[model samples]
Target chain A: MPSETPAAYDPSAYPPFAVTVDLVVLTIRAGALRVLLVRRATEPFAGRLALPGGFVQIDEDLLPAARRELAEETGVRLGRAHLEQLGTYGHPDRDPRMRVVSVAYLALVPDLAQPVAGTDAAEADLVPVAAVEPLDRLAFDHGRILADGLERARAKLTYTTLATTFCPPEFTVTELRAVYEAVWGTTVDPRNFHRKVLASDGFVEPTGETTTRGGGRPAQLHRQGSAEQLHPPLTR
Target chain B: MPSETPAAYDPSAYPPFAVTVDLVVLTIRAGALRVLLVRRATEPFAGRLALPGGFVQIDEDLLPAARRELAEETGVRLGRAHLEQLGTYGHPDRDPRMRVVSVAYLALVPDLAQPVAGTDAAEADLVPVAAVEPLDRLAFDHGRILADGLERARAKLTYTTLATTFCPPEFTVTELRAVYEAVWGTTVDPRNFHRKVLASDGFVEPTGETTTRGGGRPAQLHRQGSAEQLHPPLTR
Candidate 1:
C-alpha cells in the first residue's frame, strides 16, 4: 500500500507517464455513421488505423488539447463539433513505449469537411462505422474507444438535441430524422420521429423557413435549440 | 502543429505526467447526501480537505487502482459500491508539484462503513455535500471534480438503477425515495415516487419479504434488479 500522502512527496520521483489524447470523431455522411481515423506512420502499431490524436502539451488543458490535436493530427477543424471527454484508459501495457495514460474524447461533428493526412498520419479519412468491427481492425485499444463513443452517441440521441450537430446550420425535420437514423443505424418512422422531435421541448426551433431538399412537401427548416436534454426521450 | 506520426516517433521525449485517481465516494447518511474527504497530511494544502485519492502505480490498471486507493486512503471498502469513471481533469497547473492528470471515479456506496484516518490522510471523515458548496472550500481542483460527480449522481438517479447502490440489500420504497430526495435535494410526492419506482421495468424486485423498519403498516422489501437503465426514467 502506498501512502496517500508522503511526509514531503517528491514530485520528480513519481512514475514517468506520457499523457496523450485520442479522438473518436463521429458524423453521418451519406446515410451512414462514420468515424475519423488515421494511419499511424510510426512503429509499435505502424501502418495501422487508429484515432487521430497527439500528446497533450504540458501547458494545455484537456479540451483545448483535444481540439488542437484533432486539427493538427488530421487536418480537420472541429467547427462547432460537440466535443466531450469520453473516458480515460490506462492499462500500463496499453502502450508498449511507456506508461501512457490516454484521455479519449468524443467529437460529434456536422456532416461537413473531410480529413487529410497530417505529419503524424500516413493517411486520414472517415471510415463507415459499419466497416470497423470485431474490435481488432484498428491499432492498440482504439477500437474499444470508438465502440464506447458510438454507444454514447447512440444513447444520447434519445435524450439530447445532439442530432442537430450532424445536420447543417438549418435542416428539415426529415433531414434531422436522417441524422438519427444514420447514427442509430435504425430506421425511425418519419411521422413518429417528427412528432417526437416536435414534442420534445426546446429540441429544435423552427426557422420559419421552408426547404424543398427533403422532397414531397416543402419541409420546414429548424435549428438546434437551447435545451440540451429531451424529456420523454425518443427511444430507439 | 505536430505530426500525428513521425517516421520513428520518439516516445521517451514526451512530457512527463503524474496520473492519479480521485474518489468521490458518495453515500446517503442521516437523510442527506455526503462525500468522503480526507485532510491532506503533507504540504500542498496540508491539513485542508480534499477527495480521497492517490497515485496510480506503474503496473496497475485504472479501475483497480481506484478501488485500491479508496480502501487504502480512507480505510473504507467498496463492498458493493457502484464505482464508475466520472471524468478526467488535466489542467497544467492543477497540481503545483507537477503536471498531474487525475482520473476521477464516482462511487455510490451503501450506507455502511465510516471512514478512519489513514496513512496519507491526516484526518478522514464523511462530509455532507450540502456543506461543501461554492466549489472553493476544498484543496486543489477537487471542488470542481466533486461538482461533476454530484451532477452525474443526481442525473443518473433519474434514469438508472444506480440509486439502489445507496441502499442496503433489502429496503422499502420509502427508503429508496429518501435516497432520491437526499441526492436530488428535492422532495417528491411519496405516492408518485413509489408508483414511479415500481413502474420502472426491473428497477427493483420484491424479496418475498416485508420490513417494519420503515414504520407504517410494514412495507415490502425489494432488492436491485437486473435492469441497469430505466426506460421510462423516473423524473426528478
Candidate 2:
C-alpha cells in the first residue's frame, strides 16, 4: 500500500501463473452419450484417465485454447461442433504442484466419420456417460468437470437449439428426438416432441431427402435450421 | 524424456502463480442495468477504474474466491445474492508480469442497499451499464470481463427467471416488467409480458395486498414463486 496511485502497481509484485484449457468433448456414438477421455502419459497422475488438455499458449483466447487442445488430443476438427465456455477450475489445491488454472469447455460433436488419437497420448477412448461408474473417482477433479459439462449440456437443450449439435449434418426427426432423450436421461413423448418441432417454424426444414440407414423406416432427412436461439424455448 | 516411463511431473518443476477473482455485480437502478465497479486505490492501476476484485487465498474454490473478493471490496454479502460462475480469464500475458488466472462471476443483487468501500477499492459505485465511458479502460483485462457479464445478463433474462434477482424479495408486476425492460435495454409490451408471466405459472404469486407507495393505479403486491426453471421462456 506504499503507493496510493493505481499507476504504480508493480507487475512484478505477484507471481506468474500458468493457464491451461481442458475439454470434456461429448458425442453420441451408437445411441449413447460418450465422453472423450485421454490417458495421461506424465505424472503427478500419470497413467490415470483424464480429459484431453494442454497448457494454453499466448496469442489466443480461452475459446481457441479449448479448440486447440481438442484438436491436438483427438485429431478432430471442432468447426462443426457446438463449442462453449463451461466455467473455470481454479482451486489452489486442484493442481498439486503449480497454481495452474484451467478453463473448461463443453463441446458437442456429431458422429465422427473417423477419430484419430493424439501422438503423446497413451490411450484415448470414448466412454459412455452411464458407464462412468462411481463417477466420484475421475482423476484430477475431472469428475466434477464432467458432471458440470453434463448439466450444462442438459440445461442448454431446454432453451437453446443445441441438441442438433449431436446429430449428423442431415438427420431424421427421430434421430433428433433421440439426442434429447439421451442427454436428458429421460424418455420424451415422440408424438409430442414431433408436434413441438413442427410448431416451432424455422427450427428445421425438410431437405427433400430420406435416410434408409436405420433400416426399419425411410425417414425424411433435414439439415440444421438457422435459428440462433429458440423463441419460447423447448422446455424439458 | 530420459526415462522409458514418463517422469513424475513435479509441482516444483514450474513456477508458482497468482490466482485472483473478478466480480460483475449487477442490479437494476434508476431504470437502467447498473454494474458495481471500483476505482483502483492501489497500483497496477491506481486511480484508474476497475472491477471489484482481489487476490485469491491459499485455500479457496473459484466461486468462493469471487465471492470473497466481492465482500472484501464492496462490503456486500454474497450469501443472499444470485451468484454464478461467468467464466475465467487466463491469457498468458493477461497480467503483464506473471501468469494470473482470474475466475469471473456474475452476481445479481436484488437491491443494493448500502455499499462500504474497503480493501483495494477507492469508491465502490453503481455505474449505469450504458454510461461506462470512464470504465472502458479497466485494469488488466477486466474491461473484457465486464462486457461479457453484461451480455450474459441480457441473454439470461430471456430464458430464465433470473431477472427477478435484480429486484427485491417482494415486488409488483410493473416493477418486474421494468426489470426486464432495463436489462434488455428495450421496452416490452406490458400486456404481453404480463400475460406471458401469468401463463408461465409459478413465476409470481399474489401477496393479497397492494402497494401503497405508487401514486398512480395501486399495483398488486407479489413475491417470488417456486418456478425453478421457465419452460417456453419469455424472449425479447
TM-scores for chain B, listed for all candidates? 0.91, 0.89
DockQ of model 1, rounded to 2 decimals: 0.52
Docking class of 1: medium
Encode model 1's per-residue lDDT on B1-236: one tens digit a residue.
Answer: 12444555465578888899999989889998999887776768776788888888889999999999777765556766788999999999888877899999998888755545566636777789888756786888999999999989888887788899999888899999899888877888999888988987888999989979766798999998778775566755
| TM per prediction | 0.92, 0.83
Residue B6 shift from truth in candidate 1, angstroms: 5.1
Stretches of candidate 1 above 4 Å error? A1-9, A74-76, B1-11
Clashing pairs in 2: A5-B46, A6-B45, A6-B46, A7-B46, A9-B43, A9-B44, A16-B99, A17-B99
Worst 10 contiguous positions by lDDT, candidate 2 chain B: B1-10
The all-Cα superposition gives candidate 2 an RMSD in Å to the true structure of: 4.1
Top DockQ model: 1
Which residue runs of candidate 2 sit more than 4 Å off their true CA positions?
Answer: A1-12, A40-48, A58-60, A113-116, A185-211, A216-221, B1-9, B15-17, B41-48, B115-118, B134-139, B185-211, B216-236
Write one digit per residue (lDDT tens) for candidate 2, span A43-151. Answer: 6577677877776655566788788777766666665788888887877677775666788889988876576466554677889999985655666788899999998
- List model 1 lDDT by residue over A1-236, tens digit each: 12444566576678778898999988888999998887776777877888888788889999999988777755555666788999999999888767889999998888655545556636777889998756786888898998999889888877788888888788888898888778767888999888988988898899999989767879999998778765567747
Q: What is every candidate's C-alpha DockQ against the true complex, given to 2 decimals?
A: 0.52, 0.35
